[model samples]
Target: MSKWFCILLIACASAHAAPGAAPADDAVQVLNDKSLLNQIVELQHNVAEKAQSKLSAVGQNVSQTAYQVADSTAELVISSMGFLGLPYRRGGSSVETGFDCSGFVRAMYQETVGMLLPRRARDQAASTQVIDKKELKPGDLVFFNTMRRAFSHVGIYVGDGKFIHSPRSGSEVRVENMRESYWLKRFDGARRVAGTDAAATPPKNY
Candidate 1:
């Protein structure tokens, strides 16, 4: 064959390479660049999708947090109510042994919210995040100076100026109205568990 024919055959063979056969160096470089570009485009698309997913998850968290306060309060109140009729005991922390006012408050929070509060009423008051009575939610604590001392008593505020507590030695766990003259006079303050006000403050990004 002529030289020209041989060159034409080689060109055709190069253009129509067999499956998985090694390509010419120039052709291989062009294919590699095209494959690399496709991979880059796929990576960019994947990154965008992942970012969108994260933003969606964050939005869901904000929504859940918005309702968390009310949910937690309701759960706490429900748990406290479950202990009604249990007799009072000094420094007691369980229904089996009975419960003091502070112990009742502590146990209720621990059971309902998985949070450990200070054992004594006064210590709990000092350690918690104080809030005005007007800001009280159902699960917030209401302090009282029943023993002629600051924070001698504590109760879980159950909304509408109502609270649940284990009264004195003779009484059992009970829910009472804070508006009653007896409780009103001794009302010291109100407080919230730290970081439980997520509903009031939402994430800035969302």
Candidate 2:
């Protein structure tokens, strides 16, 4: 009888230990799964952060490029303005001496933008791209039929529908408005130089 009671007690203890051991093993497995999920989430976050950083760098590069182009264009226009009021001389081509209508345009382009334009008003118009008046912008060449021929006179377009030009042999360089009856009647057309792109692009060889 004593041997049988001892055996029965050992069997009960073993049964309870088995059930407890199963729950402990399950707990450990759950903990490992949670740790793995956390690691995956952290990895995803890191990848997103790196992608954002790269996009920001590209945005800054584009902004800098746009700024440089605008700065260069503004400088060219301002330099042309400084030559205002210089006396006009027939066939003259330099600021130190004087300038004709075409000479003035050529000198301004050369000095400010490093571009050499054709020497005569007619030739300058023929060499450039013809654009409608509605699409005109500063630095474009504006032509006039002052001598009954297309592009007999040429001028640099300033903003606000105004242009700077050497009017005639006795007149000096001056800003004139296209709205004026005299200019409006004689308006020939607008032209753009070879390197000035209508579309946005990096500065081209002038």
lDDT of each: 0.65, 0.63
lDDT of 1 by residue, 1-206 (tens): 13442344345435433334444343323223432223223322433454455457777565455355445654565456555556788979986687999999998888767789989999999999988777865567899999899999999875555677888997777667788999999999999898555222111111
TM-score for each prediction? 0.66, 0.64
- The residue pairs found clashing in candidate 2 are none
Tell me, by TM-score, which candidate is best.
1
lDDT top scorer: 1
Q: TM-score of predicted model 2? A: 0.64
Cα error of candidate 1 at position 173, Å: 0.3
Worst 10 residues of 2 by lDDT: 197-206
Tens digits of per-residue lDDT for model 2, 87-154: 67899888667789999899877876678999999999999999888776566889999998888999
